[model samples]
Target chain A: MSAYEKYLRNNRLPHILCSGCGHGIIMGAITRAIEKADLDQDRTVVVSGIGCSSRLPGYMDFDTLHTTHGRALGFATGVKFAKPELNVIVIMGDGDALAIGGNHFIHACRRNINITTIILNNNVYGMTSGQFSPMTPQGHFATTAPYGNVDRNFDICELSRAAGATYVARGSAYHAVMLTDLITKAIFNPGFSVVEAISQCPTYYGRKNKQGTAVDMLNAQKENCVTVAASAKITSDQMQGKIIIGELHKSEAPEYTAVYRNIVDSLQAKEMK
Target chain B: MSPTIKLLQGNEACVEGALAAGIQFYGGYPITPSTEIAELLAEKMPRVGSAFIQMEDEIAAMAAVIGASLTGAKSMTATSGPGFSLKQENLGYAIYTEIPCVIVNVMRGGPSTGLPTSPSQSDVMQARWGTHGDHPVIALCPSSVEETFWLTIRAFNLAEKYRTAVILLLDEVVGHMRERIEIPDHVDNVLTRKKPSVGREGYRPYQPDADLIPPMASFGEGYRYHVTGLTHDETGFPTNDTEKAGILIDRLHKKIDNNLDDIVEIETQMMEDAEIMVVAYGSTARSASRAVKDARALGIKAGLFRPITIWPFPANELKQYLPQLKQVIVAEMNLGQLILEVERNVAGKAPVHGVLRGDGELITPTQILARIKEVQ
Candidate 1:
């Protein structure tokens, strides 16, 4: 048996993801990361909002919460604040995190709470059959954007950094091993950490854009993505249209739950006096 | 030990009740008539070693409360009309997920932001149907500061006992009105959610006991389980089976409906030997109580039936009194809301008249008495 098998609910096999879907790769990476981090299974919780990616938690062997669309971060904040000892991780899709849940995403970052958020950016809403999302690139083809998307996409790593997340990183399904390493590092971060996992929705996103099968989409990621270290050495012209797939930001901040504990301690001490 | 007495606002009383009920987490936003609840809890929660968060929005606040509750904490959130509207989606999620938490809606007038500080019971219907889907609801209305204190605790107890979201529907008047209240030193019967007794291997998260409530396992208690808003089976995993969906919804309703005897509470005064009944609740009930006494003094056969548990409508209890009542007057601050329930329960056994004011004002005893005289 594989080391990650113990982390899965084997009874829930034959997941609902379509053939060539990259969400499976991301989910596998998360399980490996949790194992590598050596997090206590009983003390870990996986929360998700409504989406194809959000369904990942239901297959995992841990305390899992499948909440309303775009509200996973808010629920996760409550879980972490109420029980600071538990490790809380949130998974969301592009539309779940950026569109309907944008306000909560930014606020969760600004609070710098100790929780790991993984956003699976498949570019389009696969569950809703290729609806254009905030993370969809300009000129992308989606069911909602048959004439081609006119709205520009957001740089998720940059947005996370701007929103005050203490740790921000980006990885793709093509870089499975490195994605696991990044997720492990994010789990160790004491403040808010966001890892954007660029995933592929082959059934919807690939077909709509004629991006070929899942393998072709993954190969494209491998060809276009540049590591931050490598990008620094390349010319600006060479970096155009290239996705940076590495740790984009790291900083120290006072974690919210730890800061809140101080207030509670002092108040209890005063009452004792 | 003697209980402490103090002059407290209704919102402050709610805070006191929550503390007495051993509430460990509070998530809320700032909105008028209900803002005091958030303010006082913010100051008191940390002092008591509890967690309190002012979330980014009302929906987040409700989400936070449900999240906290899943970890076996007594969690609550407070909001007014607009915030309550924003919270409906998550509220529906809580209902479907069967997470135990308390939601305090201190209502003001509104189809949309009609009044912020004024008193209105306009949310009586919204509290039941605000969230989409056919679901059971437990809501309590408090008429005074003391009732607010006790009812807040009762709301938490019911939420935990039944494993459902309990709504404490307070109007702006009862939420903001100042009155003398005697707070008990300790709440004697604060209930917590039942925990699973079976081993982890055999435990099913959605398996109900004879009481129709499933024992809840805390997130870190080693009974690793799944919870979702989707239709789920006994194992707590989502299912697409039609029969399982029907059973899930049926159990959710039956858990509260089958146990209404313990969940419902009503106060009746001068009810015996009366031909006219006045049905009221919340701050409006205070006026109805006075009007009933005035009518009796005028030799009119009048009485009051105040439903403290507004949801589930106390229909069975109200129906029993219909035969004795020649006329029923449903007085409220709204144009009409709960009156519909009263009329339905009355079912033409007696004529039902509404004494309602939706103009950001309280329904006065004189107005209610005048209506009673006209009906007589």
Candidate 2:
């Protein structure tokens, strides 16, 4: 048996998801990361919000929390606090993370929670069938945006950096190798870390937004992407709205759990009499 | 002597109460009135290898508390007003999942961050129906700081004993008050959590053998079980079967409602021959208790009936108090929240008078006294 099978739920098979859907690919990447990290299968927790991406944990063999819309971060906060040593990972789509859960996402970054957030950014709401999202590109067409989206889109990588994510990166499902490496770095980071994977959504988002074939979308990502470090050194004219890929930000800060553990000493000293 | 008596604030007593309850984990963000609890627990919980983690927000704080409790630790979180508003969803999750945890709301002001450092009990209605579902909840309100510690311990005990979400309701006044409280040792406190009888082999996650309270098979203990907020089956899988759904709903209430006798908590002062009684809870009860004593001294028959268990609302016991009562004045910081329940219970036999203040400050004994005189 593959290392990934141990983390998969046995009862349910043949999930009701479309073919070539990137959720399965991302789940595969996550399980592989867990295997590579040698994380204890039991102690690892997977939490997700309401979306096609949210069902990933339910299909997993480990302890999972399938929570309300955009509330996965809140629930994961609980999981981490309950057992700081536990490896907690939150998996949700762009709509779930960058929109309804936008407040929590930014705050989680600021709090510097020791968890991994893998955002499957397809730029369109797949579960609810293509509603414009915070990450949806400008002029992107959706059911809700008939005349094309007029609102300026948010760059998730830039947002994560601004929100104080200790480790921030963007990888494309188009480049599976780079995506895996970025996800691994995020999982290994000690503080709030986010890896936004540009995933494919051929079923709804692709067919509607004119991204055409899944392969075409993959090529588009590859052509439009630039390394974060490369773009940082260059001016806006050289960038010209290119998707900055690779590790965007990486730094260290005192994590919440460690700082919290210090309170015991303070209280003990106070009561020494 | 037992202990030197002191006139402490209700909020201060709550801090002391949680100290006595043997709190090990406190994860809460600071909000009005309730901030004192996080303040006190942050100081006290760390003494005995315990911890107080100030989470990102109330949502994270409550989540952390719920998470900590699963590790077989006594955990709690404190909040009030808007912070309390943020905790409702997780509170419901705790209820449906039957996670043993304690939450304290030092209620002050408003439907929406109305008042912070002041007093309002509007959360009374929210505490019962705030979370968006039909599930049982065990809430306790303390009238004084003394009861604060006692009830705080009871909050943990009842949470463990019943395996349900327990609320410790304190007004700003009660939560911040400091009284000389004599807290008994660990051996003397009431603590509970059922151990698995099958020795982990025949352990079903939601299967309750006899008492309807299932043993907590903690995480990482080799006893794997799934827990969710959706309508789930005995095996903890999301299911839509009507019979299974019915059973799940029935057990949620049965765990607490059927055991209401054990869960029901109250404080009654001088009800023997009182013509007019005051019904209240939380810090307001302290004000009412004093009014009852003073009213009796002035030759007005007065008694105080306070509900310690606010959710399963002491329905039967409260119904008995309805008859032969000329008037029952329900004084609360919120604009007539708990009074609505009193009115429903008393039905019109004894005019249920409501004295309310929603501007985010507590109703004092003096204010309640004036209201009682006017009603008389």
Candidate 3:
């Protein structure tokens, strides 16, 4: 078996993701990252909500939890608290993380637990057919918005940084190597970390918006993205129509479980005294 | 832990009972009538090496409780009406996954938070059918403070034994009312979910043994199994085959239905040869219990049939009372929720009359007697 195949559940193969869905590539990147991190399979948990990206965890050979729509982070918080030794990673979609699960997404960041969240942003509700998600670009047509979505899109990396995530980054399925590195770093971060992987949904969002084939969407991401290093030197006007694909933000903060553990230990010790 | 007698409120007893039942995690938001459960647990859980968290919303609270339970902890959450409504989504997830946890819903008047401080039994049907899909439910209603303590432990035990969520139904009256009781130092019957007997590699997470209960494996126990809300086979992975889905649904129901005798619990006093029976639960049973004694003193053949376990309905056990019962009085603090169930079970064997009070007041013993006299 290949190294990536070792991380996947062989019996559950032939996953249900769309033929041209970028989620498969993102899943590959995540598995490779997990392998690179050398995480113990018995001590790792992958939690996801209801969406195309959420389905990724089911295909992985871990103690995977496919929870309710938009509630993966809340569930992950409990898992991390109940047993702080286990590594918890959450895989979510644009709709799962930024739309229906926005409240939990922000709060999870604010709490800064040792969870690595990978937001697979296809910018549409791919699993439920094409619908405008919170990350959908303005003027993009969706099933719910036939006339094109007028709502502004969220810069997910900025949102995560503002919500107090200690480490925040953005990469794309187009940048598989960089995405893997970002995910690996996020997993190793002591506090809450988020890596937003801008993915493509050729069957829905791509077809609805006339974005040609799956390859065309990947090429577009390659042509439009600027690295964080280049982003710092470029002016705002010069960077229009360009997405940044690299580590966007990184900082240090106290992890939630560690702080809670300290509080519990001291209180119990004082009682023992 | 030491045995001590103390005057305690019903909500306080719930907290004590949860502690005795080995509850290790509590994730809840503070809602009126049920806030005391969270407040007390928050202050007390850490001292006993448990974790108490105040979630942002009721959905997260329910979700977090399930997550904690998945890690082999006895977890719980408490909410009232509107919060309970928010919790139903994840509650359905808990039901489908068969995650063992307890949810304490202290009843409050509602059609969207109608009365936060007022008590009502309007959520009786909601407690059974609040979530979207058809699933098995175990709900226990306690009539007194002492019973609340013991039943709370029973709720945990049933949840663990059946691998399902158990609702500890309380009302504002019983939750806030204080009563003196002797608290046990150590509860002997506290039960935990059974772990898989085989090694992690040999375990199929959803494969049931002789008792129709699958042995549970915690997340970090080297058993890297998958759990989903979708229809799944014995391997605990989602399946799309209609026949497989049908079988899965049937098995979920049968697991509780086939073992109804063990799960359904009801109490009866002066039921033999009684011409009239008052069927009540929760705090309302207190009045009905008294009314039965009062009627007996007056030479009226009245009896009290209290359902300690309300949801598996105890229909067959209730059927035994219909032969001699000429009239059945269904008394509750709502506009006839459980009465409908009584009427269905009685099936014209007797005249089932409803004595309901939905104006945020308890149905007094006097009103119950008046109903009995009217039926006569």
TM-score top scorer: 1
Docking quality level of the chain pair in candidate 2: acceptable
Question: Model 1, B68-108: lDDT tens per residue?
Answer: 99898999999999999999999998888889999999999
User: CA lDDT of each candidate?
Assistant: 0.94, 0.79, 0.91
Share of real interface contacts recovered by each model? Answer: 0.81, 0.42, 0.77
Q: Candidate 1 clashing pairs?
A: none
Per-residue CA lDDT of model 2 for B28-147, tens digit only, reads: 897877666677666666677776677667876777677667666677888887887899988888888888888888877777767676766778888888899787878888766677
- The residue pairs that clash in candidate 3, if any, are none
Clashes of 1: 0
Listed per model in order, the count of residue pairs whose N, CA or C atoms clash below 3 Å is 0, 19, 0
Q: Which sections of candidate 3 miss by over 4 Å? A: none
Name the lDDT value of residue B4 in candidate 1: 97
Those runs of model 2 whose alpha carbons end farther than 4 Å from true positions after fitting are A213-245, A262-273, B1-9, B185-187, B195-202, B294-300, B359-376
Candidate 2 per-residue C-alpha lDDT over A1-273 given as tens digits, one digit per residue, 9 for 90 to 100: 886788787786666667878777777778877777777877888888878888788778777777777878876776776578888889988989988888889988988979999998888888888788887778878889888888877888889889999999888877777777888889889999999988888887788777778778778888888876777798899788578788888999988777766766665777786
Model 2 TM-score (B-chain only): 0.92
User: Which candidate should be chosen as best, given DockQ against the real structure?
Assistant: 1
lDDT of 1 by residue, A1-273 (tens): 989989999999979999999999999999999999999999999999999999999999999999999999999998999999999999999999999999999999999999999999999998888899999999999998999999999888899999999999999999999999999999999999999999988899999999999999999999999999999999999999899998999999999999999999999999999
